[model samples]
Target: MCDILVPLTANAQRIGTEEERKLLDQSIQLCQRLLIEVTLSEATKLVGRAEYEDALPGSIQALRFSLEIYGSGRSELIPCYILLAEANLGLSRFKQAEECLCNANWILIKTRDNDKKVKSILYRGFGRLYAAQGKREEALRQLANDVSPNAALTDTVC
Candidate 1:
């Protein structure tokens, strides 16, 4: 319901990509629960596509913007963080990815929302993060927390 405008002077580019812009438009257009759900769904699907170099950034931006508006209490926040961690994992930005996952974990526990599913995803992100750091032992430990049990998988998260 509020218009957000930023000054664009001196070769300023959009903070996020076109796909992110569209998702934000869709979320804002309706300003209803269902529309937000749709936006979250679309963003998750985009993250699941795993084309990291392209789509993930936009999805990440869209999710972050959505969270900024919706607040961290929403269930969708966990997925957004997971998607962000995955994107960072793909790009080998281990520290940022770890921070994202840690935030998700903190929210989940703080809210007392016993959603094991989201926790599993968080563990997967941790697994990937550790793997990216070449810490196989830690990676395996976290990866074991995921839904699908695997000890021999070469790259559980990465």
Candidate 2:
């Protein structure tokens, strides 16, 4: 959604669940045309709307498309894995989130691209996950590892 279309989500969501579902279904279908870029863009917009559960289907689709376009071992898959992890976290699916994060970690290790931004995101996500699970101390530890410059509010895992 563009800046001009930002109000569309908020306005339509107030109509009704069935109506929202119908519109979202159509949007998801449209996202399948280009597969990767458009789909991921929509998935990100869904996340921005705090529609994590709604984002999951598109996020999963984006992941498959990313793997198809960039292969499993490429750094490009990191964003897809992290996006799924974020959605899983939003849905309170801790195990699935952790699995997705672990896959991302494996990609980083395999590629030896343990880049700072990636580490920050991984740890930040770990922090969120641990907090969700009622492990404040562990969450703090994970957060401590998330010490990257301008990482706190500047960007996201995806």
Candidate 3:
């Protein structure tokens, strides 16, 4: 992927015709999306392997690229935020995890996104965060919402 992106990025820095510039811009965007996906996959693998320290930087990079590509309020950011929250939770950084979850919740609210799968992931992240903090009741509530069909339409945020 870097092989493709490196040349495109270098070419992007040079002056070009209007049509060429548009094509270059499109190619860059596509490459960025690929990079984001690959980074997220690697970070997720690291998190799964309980390598939170290793995952943190990649998660942050994915989040940064996602924010740049999709903007702050888009639903696309939810997964990035959730991954970051999960990594932070794994590292026992409760405050940072909560902040990331809250940012994701804010994006969901701002965008009015009602995707059940997305909400489930967000809820699960919160549930894990609360559990890590020893907030059993809060964790259970979030976990319940994660599995409850009716909870998908509700405006629940941590």
Top-lDDT structure, candidate number: 3
> What does each candidate score in C-alpha RMSD?
9.7, 12.1, 2.5
What would the TM-scores of all predictions be?
Answer: 0.63, 0.69, 0.86
| Residue pairs in clash, model 3 | none
Best by TM-score: 3
What digit string (tens of lDDT, one per residue) describes model 2 on residues 2-24?
44224332345435588888887
**Ranking by TM-score, best first?**
3, 2, 1
- Model 1 Cα lDDT, one tens digit per residue, 102-158: 877777767877666676777777877888899999888888867554422322232
Error of 2 at 117 (Å): 1.3
| CA displacement after TM-score superposition, residue 131 of candidate 2 (Å) | 0.7
On lDDT, the stronger of 1 and 3 is 3
Error of 1 at 71 (Å): 1.7
Cα displacement (Å) at residue 122, model 2: 0.9
> Which stretches of model 1 miss by more than 4 angstroms?
1-29, 32-46, 147-158
Residue 148 of model 2, lDDT score: 44
